[model samples]
Target chain A: MQLTDYEKQMLGGENGPAVARAMDLLVRYGEALGAERLVETRNVAGAFNASTPSIRSMAEDGFDRVYSELNLDSDDVVDIPHMAVPTCQLITGIDIENHALQGADPGLVDMQKDGERFFGQRGINMMCTCTPYQVGNVPVRGEHLAWMESSAVIYANSVLGARTNVEGKESTGAAGLTGRIPYWGLHLPENRLADRLIDVQVPVEDMAGWGVLGYFTGLQVEEAQPALNGISATPTLWELKHFGAAAASSGGVEIYHIPGVTPEAPTLEAAFGGNPMPDPIVFGERERVATWERLQSAEDRSVDFIMLGCPHNSIEQMSRVAELLEGRKVHADVALWVHTPRALAEVSKRSGYTDIIREAGGVVMSDTCPAISRRLPKGVRVIATDSAKQAHYLPAIAGVDGWFGSLEHCIDAAITGKWRGGP
Target chain B: MPDGQSTSKIVMRGRGVVPGKARAEALVTRQTISGWGGINEREGSVIELRHELRGQSFAGKVLVFPGAKGSSGWSAYFHMCRLNGTAPAAMIFTRMTTKMALGAVVTRVPAITDLDGDPFEMIETGDLVEVDADEGIVTITKHET
Candidate 1:
């Protein structure tokens, strides 16, 4: 890969060991992806860190070694003083703030807190979330970013019109330290053109319908760029969030285009980039129902846990949840958890949505979700969630049966502790 | 079981992403494997509930699949496989994607992709596969039943 003089200088160890090591990893990673040259970014939209059992084990080796191995993929221990670009930590392996609520061991909680402190000392914002855009890290249209988290990547690319690939933890770390990424894939405008055209014949009025559409579309065009048409109504931000999250979870779609809805797709012709649109794949109600049926795993109605957010709920979504549970209470047999960004949690608290949720016996959590943390109340036999992404993952990650539905259906399940069929 | 002489070696060519050589039994699947929580890091087993090879362990085998699915966090989980000493002996992706590329890099195994022929049609589970990443050739010796 071609590198600038400054990059070469860094590669030559002129700028110090940490930057040099980070540059080396970036160059190799670019080469691995067949990227020709590195691109510079002025507005780096922060990064999401990946925490695993192996990464957690690095505590014994100390923070320097941990940073070196996890981020730089180097064995050499080097001190990283600060990120070259602004950075924020992503959802971790366990909920550090409320481990007891998740039924986690004390040692696991200590490990998470220690990791947080180490990252915080290095200038990484500790607002761990998949939806960093909700927490004031919003990137503008056409901005270049190095972000991880599948949902965030799709949202940045499709909704925000920012350019970013679904970056891995290592590459994002390198970008945080070097403010550079390989200029290939979704970073290039030519690759962003829609290859598959999807016509939404089904009426997608709610978040669940949009999720089903996205799930169906993603399965149809696996790894291919898709553009949607024939959608009469404009979707809300929350609906788009569900659409992108579900599509990205079920398929390998890094970017998508919704004509007149998402930025860069002002019209169907523009979404196709002057090329002839491919034959449209019809997403009808039958397909949507089938997709929804596939997500349901529970044979019985009993639900032990009800989780509200997957990509971390926005403040608006939290407000809606609060409104739904206003005068109700979560069933004694059900443990209802509402996941959101820490910043949004603060806003929800100020708005009294947190108190309302608390009064209803639901815990409003931040910095983590069951999908990333891989934690749930012990012996949770069945789980209900409004997120298609969460429903697709919880069975495998948490070893529980899943019931996927709308927010109202999930709230109803939380109240009655029973999933009385579909909404 | 058939005699050793009955086993025939078939050589297929592809591009090598990581440089190494290993011969192991193959665990093939057409479904793309999810990166996050898809595999058990400790045991190196496919834990994706609906995956065809659900309970099968990929440890010490050649993992043949259509490439990675879901999150970019895929590399981190596979990286843990390396640290835990439970990674597959080698990997063969039918189609290369960014996530799978990073996974191959972090796993540091003999990995190949963009084959001359479809690897899914050519390889099967239990086949003794030898990967020469340096030469970009995979020698498959089918198990004689």
Candidate 2:
């Protein structure tokens, strides 16, 4: 890999120890990917998922230390969130909140606190939550990038067509400091192509259906991008969020083209950029049903837990849920949770969605999800949700009788405290 | 470079991410790792829940998978693996998740995505394999005593 003069000077400690240290980390990152050289990143997006006290303390301390050591400019504002959110549920252990706050096994609260400290010192704008794209930081196509999530990476690559390597937490910190990344993969046009093809002939109407289809297509496509055709439904930006999230979770897709949506391809041939699709797969009812089955547990019984917001709930999502539960109440036996960033939580509070959801017997929490905090009420024998991505992972995270259905089914379970299958 | 090994064998057909070449042992995962707590940046080991390959090192292996499971943090976990010297030699996405793709790109490990067969069915833990991310081809050579 070639290094520029500035890079060499930084690596050689000609730029001082702090720049050298920061460059040194980036250089390792560059070498790991065999990047020929590093390119400067612009409009960089920062994200971190530290959920342990010790690690969080280190991260928080490191951010401050690195900032002061380098004397970074304030204009290089960071986009880190003030707290952490649960990314998964605990399979073992008791007392969800207690486990997250004061467990023998390091808890997530400390991680949140430490992250807050680090970004706080730098005056980094920390918008805690995985789905930063939905919040206005959405990068335009062909933008150089850095982010710290699988779904976001996939979304950035596939949905947004922005170039970013699925960077780690420290990578974001280093990139944030140095403002550089090894340009390759998704950044390159050659890497984003329709290596495979899918003819979507199903009637995918809602987010749930989109989630199921995405999971199915990802399962079928696995590691390749597919040029989709015959998509009867023109998914809204909101629906595409679920599709992109599920697609990335089910497979590793850097880019995908919906006939009318996205830029690279206006037509199937254009999506492939004139390249022939070697294999064309058809997705229909059976495929969707199979994917639904794979994402859900076969068990049929009363459900005790229901969760939403895998990518962190947006204010609009909260408002929608609020509308859904205006006159309803969550099941007495079921515990429902909605994950969001504290910043958005404040907005939800002012918007009255918080009160409505809370009145409906669900808690609107921040800095954690059932997955990351390992905080799910004990003995949740059955769990149901509207997210296919969440349903797919919940079994491994928490041993609940899990089921994946529409929002109605999830809300119904929340209302009746029983497992109800969807049609 | 091993004797009697074919370099262009099709391992599995899932999604494809990076375009390069790498060879090493295969790390198979059933429950994908979470990006947040799934990887220890300092240690570079899989630290997520119920993962069959949990606590296992990712040093120079032809990592195989159905795909990443949770959190946008998935890409970061793999990125940490590269930074801390525990990176996989090559990665085969049995399926591609956005995080996995970004992780592959950030780590710059030779990653071959979009396999021709089910990697989970064909490749098992401890299998010797070679991946060509450029051609989207993965070759597995059965190790003989």
Candidate 3:
């Protein structure tokens, strides 16, 4: 891999020991990916908190030890420095406001608080949500970014027309300190072209339809980029967010194109970028029903828990949830949690949506979700969610059955404590 | 019945990823593994529901698989596996991705990929294997039936 003089200087420890270690990890990671060079990136989002139980013992020593071993992949502990580029924190394992409801230990909450203070002082913005683009870090088209979170990576690459592969925690850590990442995968212009094509037979309407279509796309495309055709409706940020998140969860899908819907492809002819588009795989009603059925892991009708957001809801989605629960009371057996970003959570509270939902026996959560934290209401045996990503993961992660449906079905389940959803 | 199986030795060549050497029993799976919610690093076990390797521990064994899937938390979770002393003895995979490469780098285990022969066909669970990632070579000793 080629390195500039400035990079060489950083590797030589001219900036500091932590920067040197960060550069070394970048080199090692870059070489492993067959990356020919390092790309400069001022936009970075990474997973850097000492939130989980696995990091509990490491936190006892110092945050530096945790950063040295976990972030830099280095054995030596070095004095950390301020980030050389713009960086923000992603979703962590614990929600500070609802840790008790999440069954999280108080000590772990303190550990995460200490971690925030330590990294926050060094200029790492605590955005603390997966949807950084939804907040304020929207990168321009063709811009290079080093970001973690598979859902956000797919969104940036596909919807925003920005370029980034699915970077990991360690690589993002190095990029935060040195403003560099491996120039491979989606960074190159030629690699972003779509090769797999799928024709949508049914109306890809609403978040639920987009979620099912996204799930099917992941299974078919796997790691490859896909192009969608035969769309009848234009999707907003909500549908696309759920679509990307669902695709990333079922398989390792980084980027996909919807031809007219996505930014890069204005037409079907332009989507392939001169690459040969494969024979169209029809995603008819049969496929949609099968996809929806696969997401349903629950056999029983009783739903004790209802989780509304996976990629974290937008303000509109929060309002929609509030509007649905305005006159109803949550069933005595059901516990409901609606998640949004902290920045948006404030708006939800101020907008009266939070109070309405809370009065109806639902909690508005921020900063984390159940799947990420591996926590739920005590003894949750059956779960229902409107998110395809969350429904696919919560059952597997929490050892409980799950039901996937529309937002109305999820709200009905929360109010009646019954599973009324079907394919 | 235990004596009825063939004990054949097979040798294959691939690219060295992590640059080290390790020898251990091979635990093979064709399914791609996820790191975040799909695994329990503290216990070194696959926890993803409906995964074929669910409840199986890769600790002190050669983990042969397709590659990584799901979250960008792949490397961090595998890195925690190394710190907890629950990582696989060696990593021999078939596919390459940013997630797989950085994961192997941070796990700091002997890793090899892109072999000339199909690793899934030639390797199976409980097979004694040697991974010399520095030289990009793997030797498999088939186990008893």
Candidate 4:
């Protein structure tokens, strides 16, 4: 990899040991990925540290060792005093506030608290959300960033028009220290061009429909950049969130283009970057329904848990849930947990959405989801969720039967403790 | 080391991203492994309930799969596997993506990818495999029953 003079200096330890080590790792990582050069990341949109048992086990070895081993892949411990740019934590192993609710032991919770404090003291924002953009870490169009979360990576590249690859924890951590990343993959302009075209034949009128469309599209164009056409209406931010999250989960889609909807693709021709568009892969009602059915594994109608907010709920989504739960009560046998960002939870509290859901026998939590927490109550054999991403992961992670449905359908399931299975 | 006939070796070549060597039984999965909490770090087993290899342990075997899936935290979990001494001896990926590449690096396992043909088509579970990643060769030794 070709390194600039500044990068060379950093590699030579002119800046500091930590920065030098980070630069060295980035250069090697870039070379391993066939990158020709490194690029300057204008701002660190967010940095998600990996919370694993190995990481927690390294607590005795101290934070520097944990960062070195997990993030830098080195044994030489170095202090990361501060990130060069603004950064935020992603969903950690345990919900710091509701550890008992997630069935976490006291030791695990204390370790999580230590991890939180380590990053917090280093000037990293301890938001602990997958949806950082919703919580004051928004990166604008054309900005270069090193982001680690898959959903956030897809959303940044596809919807926000910002450039980022699906960075691993190591790469993102290195970028946080050095404020740069290798210029390769999705970061390149030519690589961002859409190679596949998708025609939406079904009416994608809501967030669930958008998720289904994204899920199908991801399977159709695995690891390829896709441009969508034939959608008549403009999609909201929440819709795009679901779409990007599902696409990233179902497929290895790092970036996508929607000609009229997204920022980069102002026109079809522009989306293709002067190249000829491939034949459109038609996504109709058949594909949509098939994808929805594939996500549902629950044969029984009874549901023990209804979980929402896989990608972390935005304020609008929270408001909608509150509106749906008004004057209703969750089933006595069911537990409904709504997850959002900490900042958004505070906003919802001020707006009374949190209280409304709590009054209805549902709990609104923050900073973690089922996939990250990897725990559920002992009797949670059957679960229902509105998010396609959650539906895809919960079964694999928690070993629970899942029912995928629209937000309204999920709310109805929460109310009656049964999944009738419809929007 | 078996008392059967001479070991029959079928050698295949690929790009070696990490340089090392290992010999172990193969644990093959056509589906990609989700990174975060996809495997139980302490046990080194596939805990993803929907995965074909769910509940099966990948510890000390050559983990063969299509590639990585899910969060960028994928490498982190695999790294934990290494720290816990429960990671696979080596890995063979049909397609190399950022998540898996980083994972291969962090785990420091003898890893190879971009094979001449599909590794899944040829490799199977219980096959005795030898990976010479430094030489970019994967030798599958089929032990006759």
Best-fitting candidate, scored by DockQ: 3
**TM-score of chain A, every prediction, order shown:** 0.96, 0.85, 0.99, 0.97
In model 1, state the lDDT of residue B143: 79
DockQ comparisons of all candidates to the true complex:
0.72, 0.20, 0.83, 0.61
Overall local distance difference test of candidate 2: 0.65
Local accuracy by lDDT, each model: 0.84, 0.65, 0.92, 0.84
Q: What are the per-model numbers of colliding residue pairs?
A: 0, 67, 0, 1
Colliding pairs, model 3: none
lDDT of 2 at A157: 70
Candidate 2 lDDT score at position A295:
80
Model 2 C-alpha RMSD vs. true structure (Å) is: 7.7
**Candidate number that wins on TM-score, 1 or 2:** 1
lDDT of 4 at A135: 81
Worst 10 residues of 2 chain B by lDDT: B7-16
Model 4 ranges off by over 4 Å:
A45-54, B1-8, B143-145
- Please write out the lDDT profile of model 4 over residues A1-423, one tens digit for every residue: 898898899899888888888887887677667678988885553444434454566777778877777777776988776887776677766777777888887876777787778888887888788988888778888889888888989998988889998887788778888888988888878889999999888789998888888888777887788999987889998899999888887887889999888888899899999898788898877788888888787899999999999889999999999999998999999999999998899999999999999999998888788877777766899999989889888887777899998999999999998898763
Q: Which ten residues in a row have the lowest lDDT in candidate 3 chain B?
A: B1-10
Distance from true location, Cα of A39 in model 3, Å: 0.5
Candidate 3 deviant stretches above 4 angstroms = B1-7
Cα-based lDDT at residue A306, candidate 2: 86
